[model samples]
Target: DIQKKKQGTFLPKEARIQPAAFSMAQVAKKPLPKAPAVSIQEEEEEEFKISTGMEPGKTYTGQKLDLDLQDIDLDNVFRLIAEVSNLNIIVSEKVKGKVTMRLKEVPWDQALDLILSTHKLGMIQQGNVVRIAPLKDLLDEEKERKRVKQERLQAKIEAAKRLQEAEIEAQERERKLRPFVTEFITLNYTKAKDFQAQIKDILTKEPKLERVGTAVVDERTNTVTITDYPEKIERIKQYKEKVDKPTPQVLIEARIVKATKNFARELGVQWGAQYAEYDKRGEWAWGVSSATGSGTTPPVTPSSWQSGSFTQGTGRDFFPLSGWMVNLPATLLPTPPGIGLQVGRLVGDLINLDLRLSAAEREGLTKIISRPKVMTLDNVEATIKQGREIPFTQVNPEGNVSVVYKEASLKTTVTPQISPDGRVRLKLDVTDDFPDRSNANPITGNPEIVKRQGTTEVLVRDGETVVIGGVLEETRATAEDGVPWLKDLPGLNWFFERKTRRHDQTELLIFVTPFIVQQD
Candidate 1:
């Protein structure tokens, strides 16, 4: 019994209650399982560092990437947008561990044979870091955060990439401008001859002149003058911007001669900016100013006589156009800006004027609208009776009244006619889609014009009205006073568009047939 109690610990209680076949020795004699080697992960936990923010060395506390992994690759656009992350990696168990240089910002879940990318690993939350990889690689992370975090990361990355690209483009432009510094110089000259003389004067006066700065000034009187020597001048940067090609419009070559104010006169308003020159009396000259040039706005280029024209505004084909006016050239010339869209608009006023569609062009359009083949003709008539007989009135048996077939009289209309004095008469048009005989029907442009040829279905897209002449002329009551029920009378705007189908052809015929009224 004591032995049984000791064995009870080794054997399950239920098993002990039952009759057992093997003893403890037999059970011990069975081989023990070789304990499998377990790779202790504790040491690996320490090697990883947490980072966040712009700091380079810090490790993210924890992160998760949420990406709606599309089937297509974003083509490495990840770097162009994300800003926070510094390093990213792409991993593959295939190729016996091959890797590509993972530039940051890989998209999530693109089609790749077998490759995974990670922005952060090592037991971090990963919410802040944004990286992109294939859909299959999503499980590769040691840990993952929620989806909202991934979107934020992606947006940041895109913004960063855009800024970086802009910087690079700017740098390239500066490189190009480096050589032009020696060759290009700004000088204010009134005439071509004067400019040449000014350059010669510059050669004699300035010593070791690597670069020169010039500005245009106006005389106290309304003439333009040039100031050759500038005390302190800002560099004229040549930046590359995408500009659409120019289209033709009215061209004007004018200067701001008469400004509204003395202060505006002093600033040398630029011709292409959003400023006005008001005189001391509060009167003003509109358009652009040249005294201070663009001021806070962008620049307006000065025009040359030959290449002087520039495109103005947008989609504006003519001058003296809406919200714009004309200014004569050789007025008060503002400082020469190379040219701008505004200046182009100003120039357009003088040279091109406004070129609206000419009379000939308008007439040409009129001829087309009134041409034959465009306006098809059809025959319309009344069918009160067979063989063209008049309709008559009749009373039905139920004490009800009705119009007999002979009671109705039909008025006739022919095609447009010209008088006998050199006037050509137009006969009633019998319209047919195909050259065929007209059935005894008096409808215009039958929808089932080819019904004889066997057409089963027709789809009505739109419908219109063709008024009968006599029905349109008659009014039930005075239209002037519109007394009480007079406006509600049947014939006033009460007519219906009539359509009937032929028995044999099933052709649809529409007519402006007449209807009678009931009197009190």
Candidate 2:
């Protein structure tokens, strides 16, 4: 009745109220309930919901946004980005700068980062909540966290150190309470007393164990008794094992040859000739002959001294009138002619003799004095002697005469060191002593002692030979023989008398070879 007059409406259907308006009106009629009071932490948790299908601590790939902004507040920009990305953002009070940027289709997270960087601001994200603050405040918080972590680590280290010290103290106390153990070790080559001395020296250096360790030597059994803690005893046993093995032995073979300068080469040739003769007859024979004459007497052929079996033959006359010539058997033809020189024609033919002679002339030229082979322990000196001792009368201050013996001999002394690589280092001392018959004492008629000595050190491989030389001796002599009255005439001396000058030289050569003896 009150609305009897109906007003005409010109509103379009699209602009009229929809069915949702009734529900909205009903919702407004309900009393607005009071929101529960929330703490800052609760509010933050409520604002930030974990993103769906994303793990915590994962990099956020937020929604892309295209924004054209001009001098916008940094906090507003962060809020805008948070809204676009559906992320919870908290802006610090210290964040008050404005940013001007035009970003097209950039990730929301990246755009937020750009705004924060330009303003010297920083962010800390926990799950979906992002905190915005000044960079200085964030740096201070990070430093504080590191300082706390370092303090915790240092505390753990100190606790561990204290625990270790306590354990070491317990072990030391237990060791002191333990009884000493004794062990006996027998030595094969090394002296027990020597090793005991070494062990004593080692113990003296250890302040904690010096009083506890003892080493005693029993010479009768060549045994060393060690008394110490079990651990120290084991260490001593190991050390003894390293040093108590057998000492190596060295077999030194030495050849002492007194020869001329050309002896080595001439000896080689002589050996070759002997080998050739041996090949022809299956055996070789060497013969030597000598002839001596006072005046012009016809030379007599000496008997051939044979070294091997051969048929003897009657000699034929080769020279008719020359007293210097003699018929030699054909089998002894290889003997050097210089060995059979006649004393009558020796001065006349001496000028025509060859300086290089064969091995048959060894009696006057080259001689093998001695070949001494000795076996000795490594680093021990070995000596060899080949001559006699001479006696001399010594008158003391009391006017009593006594005989004193002096060694006049050829002696060789060598000390050899064996290396692990099968090499030998040798220290050599050689002495050659002889009587000088040409110079004799006036009253005693005793010859003066002539000594030649050589000393050297050399390194050579096992079983290898080394030669040592340089001791040389030289002699010169002159002789004249002829008819006495005719030789006295100065003008006719050349025709009647024969004068000869001879020069001789010899050297001492030592050939040494060392062999390492293998243990059986």
TM-scores of all predicted structures: 0.13, 0.52
Candidate number with greatest TM-score: 2
Please, what are the lDDT tens digits per residue for candidate 1 over residues 1-520? 1133332233222222110242435433343233233344542333323322223453333222222222222232232112112323222222122223332222322212113223221112233333333333444432343344476689989999999999987876664344321232333223323333434433213223433434332333322233332322111211101111121111111111112122121222122223232223333222333223223433223331111222233222222234322221222223221212222222222112112112322433111111011111122221121113233344566867565342222222223222222212222211112212234234332222221111011111011111110000111232233345655667862333233333221111112111111112
Top lDDT prediction, candidate number: 2
Measured over all alpha carbons after superposition, the RMSD of each candidate to the real structure, in angstroms, is 39.4, 18.0
Overall lDDT per candidate, in order of appearance: 0.26, 0.58
lDDT of 2 by residue, 1-520 (tens): 0112123212222221112113223322343233334476664334332222223464647656666666556665664555455567777898786666666666666666666666777776665566777878877877766686689789999999999999987887776677778888888888998988877744423347334577888999999888776777778778888988888999998766777755543432111111001112323222212232122223222221212222334132111333323321111212211111111111112112223232425456667677789999999999977788888877788988888788898777889998666778777776767877677888676778876555545555677655554445567899989988988887887788988999887755566778899998
Please estimate how well model 2 matches the true structure, expressed as its whole-model Cα lDDT. Answer: 0.58
Question: Which ranges of candidate 1 are over 4 A from the true structure?
Answer: 1-27, 37-241, 244-520
Candidate 1 local Cα displacement, residue 165, angstroms = 22
As a TM-score, model 2 comes out at 0.52
